[model samples]
Target: MAVPETNKVMRLLEGRHWELREGPFKRLGEGADQRLREIADNTSLTNYLRFRALIALSLYDNEETGVHLERHARSGIRPLPAEGFHP
Candidate 1:
């Protein structure tokens, strides 16, 4: 997705203004982890999206997600574009 569109989604997610009709994990089941892994692994995506996916995985509180989050934290990678919002 384009940066603007991705940013819009991020805002909705972060703002808690959007509700999942079906919980993502429930809807995707085991595939949720796979999808998160794919998003986390894809370097082409904005850091905001990748980080958000990582955070979502962490929220699931699974061992794998914890490991991934730990690795990501240790990497010290900063989000691209620096700032997420503009007035």
Candidate 2:
């Protein structure tokens, strides 16, 4: 059977809440880029880091696509809630 993902991995996959406030694929820019660079130089860690980056990017990209679709589907609706507004 496949092993269940740990909370730490899930958290990384989900990313920080602050990133979500900005946009869907929030860390696709400088931060991930820099970390990947640092990891690339180390052969032992490069594979693990690259895998983590791929997982994070995939989750962020998938979420972003979903968000865009939701927005398009609701284009005629009233304005969305401001960032901090919950329900």
lDDT of each: 0.53, 0.37
**Model 1 CA deviation exceeding 4 Å by range:** 1-22, 79-87
- lDDT for residue 73 in candidate 1, whole number 0-100: 70
lDDT of 2 by residue, 1-87 (tens): 332233323344343342323342343433442333233233453244433433344343345434544543476743323212231
lDDT of 1: 0.53
TM-score list, all predictions: 0.56, 0.24
